[model samples]
Target: MLKIYRNTSIFIFLVIIGVQWGFYKNYTSEFPNFIGKTNIIHIHGALLMSWLVLLIVQPLLIKTGRTQLHRTIGKVSYVLGPLIIIFLFLIGKGSYWRAIGKVPEHDILRDMVLDSRGLISFAIFWALAMLYRKDAASHMRYMIATGILAIGPGVGRGLINSFGLGIGTALTVTDLIALAIVGFLLGYDIYKKKNYKPFLVVFIVFLIGAFLWQVRDSDTWQSFAKSYASMFY
Candidate 1:
């Protein structure tokens, strides 16, 4: 099991950073002289990227037999985790508001569903990972799930920016990729006769999120979204 996770986080980190760099190549091209970049955006990027960095570092510490160092670094998530949730919500809300009138209402609402789903899924997985911190196997799996959730946005952006795919199609492709990854992990765990519940739960969440847009036309969702945004966003 440890071998299975040895470099998995590194692979996830690279994929996430690669997709994000490709997707936002234009913005990143500006480099140190990033004009028009807001502080919120900077903070948001820092928070998320830091979490990914931690994921990479933590596994390495363990692999090096530095268990104490790994535990110390893991504690950083106590502060980092909540900051991530807050900023992710802020960034998503900011984008939604900024897109008003500029982007179509249907598209905006659909995007919101996908964004909120990812946010909810990340929070759930993170919480579970922390809750199961004593159980190394479960804890690592849930943490991996959170990393998998982060991939969706980067992949969506990559699909759109690299291939000029429409937002809907890009998002759909991202969902498919995420589901496939989780499905493969779940199958592997089952085959090994290991506990598969964690991956199974994450797979269900992603599946629901993939098909969630089908309910965007319902009045209840629209009303709730607007109300929630008005209060929190």
Candidate 2:
């Protein structure tokens, strides 16, 4: 079990880089000039980045035998985690408002499904991680799952902006990458005879998200998404 978590920091660091690399073309490239961006974007970026940093450092702390410090940071996440989720919803709300009348119903429906499912998945993973805090193996796996979840938005956007893939293609590729990571983890867990349920659960959640994306154009989803968006301010 300890062996499985030993490389968590390295994996999370790579994910951090992937996220930044994805966002750079459109978001970070502007750098100091963040002129037109809203407060929610800045706040969400700060909170999400902080969570990523915490995710990376927490594992390193445990690996280095700084269990006390790891616990301290874990406690901090009691506040930090919910804030990140709230900001995610706010960002989604902002997206809905901004895209209304500007994009087609299909686009709006798809975006909402992606946004809502991502939020729900992240919340589920984080909550389960918190609940399993006493179970190091489960906790660590779920924490790692959150980092995987975080990478999708930036990476998907990067694919669109940098590779010129259409939004649909970029999103599909991003979902594939996420599932690939989860699949590798699940497979390795099985090979090592470790508990594979954590990654299996994450994989199922992600698959559901991907499935929703595939069928987001359906009238049922479109109507639900419209109603979901209306729930926000």
Whole-structure CA lDDT of model 2: 0.86
lDDT of 2 at 186: 96
Residue 35 deviation, candidate 2, in Å?
3.6
**Tens-digit per-residue lDDT, 1-233, candidate 1:** 46666767667777677657554765667778887777787898788778887888888778878999899889999999998888778878887888898987756665678668867888898999999999988898888887887677787777778889987787788789889999999999999999999999989989998877557656767776667677877
lDDT per residue for candidate 2 within 1-233, as digits (tens), equals: 45545578778788888789888876788888875789899999999899889988898888778999899878988999899899889888888888889998678767788779978998999999999999988998899999998667878887887778988888888889999999999999999999999999999999999888888888889888877776763
C-alpha lDDT score of every prediction, in listed order: 0.81, 0.86
- Which run of 10 residues does model 2 get worst, by summed lDDT? 1-10
- Give me the runs in candidate 1 sitting further than 4 Å from their true place: 214-220
**Candidate 2 TM-score over all chains jointly:** 0.95
Best by TM-score: 2
- lDDT, candidate 2, at 148: 91
lDDT of 2 at 36: 70
